[model samples]
Target chain A: MTAALSTGPITAEEWGIVSLSLRVSAVSVLGAAPLGFGVAWLLARGRFAGLVVLDALVHLPLVLPPVVVGWLLLLGFGAQGPAGRLLADWGVTLMFRWTGAALASAVMAFPLMVRAMRLSIEAVDHKLEAAARTLGASRARVFATITLPLAMPGVLAGLVLGFARSLGEFGATITFVSNIPGETQTLPLAIYAALQTPDGEQAASRLALIAVGLSLAALVTSEALSRRMGANVHGL
Target chain B: MGFDIDVFLQRGGGQIVARFSSGAALTALSGPSGSGKTSLLDMVAGLVRPDAGRIAVDGKVLFDSAAGVDLPPHKRHCGYVFQDYRLFPHRHVEANLLYGWQLAAPRDRWISLSEVCELLGIGHLLRRMPGALSGGEKQRVAIGRALLSGARFLLMDEPLSSLDALRRAEIMVLIERIRDDLGLPILYVSHDRNEVTRLAGQIVHLGAAHGVAFATDMSQGEQGKACA
Candidate 1:
């Protein structure tokens, strides 16, 4: 415990890890939210051919091992992969970079977000949407007005869950981006590295505590925000 | 000068058929439960597509199988007040009224928001959410939202059914006032014969279970033969 205190509250290296974790998580959430919303809406309301297949496919990532996902990302986004070559030529290299780390985190956390969003969208009353239609609102307008506002609570929950998941992502981020210091080293990766060192156990424990604090803080913030919005919508 | 819908719809596992070619402006489809009344209105609202039929309103073709035309729900300029008063619970009353106004064509903007709010007596609840309002207030908001849509044809699917007796009585006078003042042609659906007598200009009666449906002018008391 004295050794933990001696390691200091926020060393430069530890701070780097904390900020990188936050940045990666934020980027991943922003990139994945709209896609999650669309996928969830489809799973909830859309009735077409292959709907069951699509639902199963979207949930596959949640059940798959994070290491496997990292391996798939490496195969698809490596320097020699088809998509990687095109991206490289366009000056947008993702392999082994911080962006690749974020992408990996997004892939791992996507299923949770989609699941939350799907449930909320399904809970929205279809009668309201039909009424909006008769009121001359188009499909997009109706969704924006009626569906989106009502489903915001689930969306907020998904965002918090995704951000927390992304912040702690280890296996996928390391496998996909190689856990480089000052670049791909997120909080979890830094903690793992510290634990592997002979005298770095103190630093690792501190980082682990910070990770726990972050997850709890994220959850609290999400709940507070959702409650405020819900109250506002409910006129309380 | 209003519209003509000449269609024959098979009802109840094809055991009965109801045919109508009426061009009346304010037609009321009224009957008891399981009378195929809602289905008849759905056919006009472009919700439930007919197998072989043609629907025209004010010389505009809505669904014409002969011409291979079927306008979807969004394209139809029809205002609807659902039986459950389907007000969007997430939105404020103002946003609910604006939703339809934004979707209307630039040239089709006939009804103003102020006019609708004034008519429905919901001007004070503009910022209020649906959950905050009473049952009667929600129905009035729903009616106002429907009317602000600039719909050429208005359809009310038992709009007053969910309200209490006192609220229903209040809304009944409001409906009558809307009919007389606004001059908006409406297609109102109800199961109550008293409501039909009170509000219907052209009444279309539907039978229970597997039976026929035919139209008559309730105001003139013309009873046409009920075809089986």
Candidate 2:
């Protein structure tokens, strides 16, 4: 609060962190989309047993400390853990790697994505899906042609929220993957590291500005896309 | 040679049992509100399960609780035109027409998209969304969608009830022409006496105390008297 925001340029390392943040967040959102859609569909349409428990579990990451989520992930997916060892044998790794950061970000961002998608999926008219059925369209076909199209706006908004969450992710990522310079470090991590040094405020302030700018851009794009897609579906 | 149905189900407080068979060119299910008319149609279309009953369309068993065979709605091959049209708002008119046709087997494909559009007089509305169309236009598109699916039978539930008087008359004429040209048997459901008198070749009446009544050889005058 005391110092004015820095208008100085970023160093090459800072640029690397920004690029890494985008990549990690992008990968997280892209990888999580299909799974997110599945969870959302289940929550929106499924009436099976333990549904409440499943929903609560999905949102656990949001309420829990990010470090706790990171630790749980590590316990289940660490190098020597059951899943982690299996993956390591296959030459795939998650612990302390960039992939782990993405995974952690994905977990942290999952609830918001699912909530947005669920709302959209629920908004779709069951009658339209029934109509598709009478036309010989199967459940899967009906979802593709009717339910998904009507829910496009929600899906986009979910993706935007997830992407922003992934970018801003720090605690889970740092705890899960550690703050390595070129590997697991992202924009948030970079900012945190910068704030530690006495004269590193300038770099931290610049990175903070980039984060704010990226988030604002994502929100604006999502808003515009949602409105346009909603209008198109509504035929307005 | 035609559709056979013996549907019995409970809804809310009362029981609904409808039994009928008709090979006629156009059969009508006419009843007042709360008469389970739409429920009967939904059972035939495989959208609702008829407890302890059987339904067959052209000798093909679509549902049979005794035999443990209940085909899903997609496999019923019964074209349904809902009262509200239920067209996909996201798709254009052409896509709506093609939706069912695309799911049809190659050998089962007989009606073309342009053919149905031309028949319905919706050729120029191909690129238009459903919301942009008039009530008559939407009804035509819905009919076209059902017909292109190569459905063995058609079940129309108050298809013209949403249209104004002028649009209703116009669409009825279109329906008559399509019925004459295709000669496919239709199960038309409506409470409107005029629509029944104009279109029905057979009548299936359901009521609270009457249960279900089936009458064939329906002439214009007979239908008018029956609905009266």
Candidate 3:
């Protein structure tokens, strides 16, 4: 396998893997953010029965093995599963598809996103919201104009963290969607595949460097956004 | 314009029972610390729910336990000037002023942004953030914010307590102008007897026992007379 691998440059095939990884991570973060924020808000402020259970459920992925999470996703969204059957009626499928990979990434990234968002939402002074209410702002308007803006830095951090987590996702994505070449072969999967060969060390190293670069960029972006937003909220 | 308030609230280890009515432009609530002055204001602003009783301003019933009417804070339209000013720290002075103004119905709105800014002398501070504002300036902005929201009445909870003597006097004159010119009923909270005597038309004292005593100061003229 090492003899057959090209150690020169990132081939077009490798580029496809990088692109697919980026797409999967972006889609996962975008799709999960609203749900994450809602869950975070509920955990932060909502008072209700079974709250502890809901919290535990939200954080289940963080503690559970990634393979178990993937297996759970497969059970719920695979072609023959209940949700999968319902989706199939709508002419949609997730099995071995990039969409399935995105779903797996989203599930794995959700806990981190929710945690960051919850902390931020909790930090927002309830007094400000009460003041808004006194000023004739409805609950929705108060959240939109005051609470959400004040929590922007946390929300940004959650998004970047989720995106990075999704990019590096290997166990869940591989277990759920498998390593299909163009459809689901993300960077981690490609790097893993390269490592399995005897002469593919150089190829794996190159892909690993790319992964490191991408994660660094995401973190830097998060820091920059959080700093700017924190300044806007406090300075202005 | 006046206030008719009788509310009962159960706090930790005690109950807060307040009953008073005033037919005056400015009704003062004078009490020592921990006498439920702020709690009563919170009830009027719908921030705190009373166990039972009624809250009416200018003949408009805001909360009536018997009638099962409990309007939310947004619908009550009681402009509150908190002791700490409670200005939205993230918003500029202008945005804070406009927050309520934008929410008010056109027919309900009686004061414009420019008018409030001019009246409170906060026009020059509009672009400044609440973080950068002095205590006096923040209080003025808070007052302007409440007024611009189309408030039918005002609730000032020790609005001058956090200010210096000079700023307190300045705001006292501004409050007088608002009372005489705008004609909006004001429920002012203060611990200083002299300050209340200078500004309040009628004074209601809250004792340490949680009892309320109504006083009509003849020196303040007929406008200071309470009906009950």
Best by DockQ: 2
lDDT of 1: 0.78
Q: Write out the backbone clash pairs for model 1.
A: none
Candidate 2 at residue A135, lDDT?
94
lDDT of 2 by residue, A1-236 (tens): 12434664565666788899999999999999999999999999999999999999999999999999998888878977898988988999998789999999999999999998998888788888899999999998988888888998899999998999999999988888999878998989988987987888877778888999999998897788678666755661
Structural similarity to truth (TM-score) of each candidate: 0.87, 0.90, 0.92
Arrange candidates by lDDT, descending: 3, 2, 1
Poorly placed runs, candidate 2 (over 4 Å): A1-10, B209-228
Candidate 3's interface RMSD, please?
Answer: 2.1
Error of 1 at A206 (Å): 1.1
For candidate 2, write residues B1-228 as lDDT tens digits: 466777788777777877767766778888678788888888888888877788887789999999999999998887899998988888889889999999999776778987886777888999988889888888889999999998878899998888899998888998788677786778898888888977877777766655443222243323222321
As for lDDT, the candidate ahead, 1 or 3, is 3
Ranking by TM-score: 3, 2, 1
Q: What is candidate 1's CA lDDT for residue A224?
A: 81
Which candidate number has the best lDDT? 3
lDDT of 1 by residue, B1-228 (tens): 344565666655542245443344456777676666677667767777877767776678888988999887778888787777777766778987887888888788887888887778889999988778998998888888777778877788897887889999999999898877776667788988788778876676665553655443343224222222
Between 1 and 2, whose DockQ is larger?
2
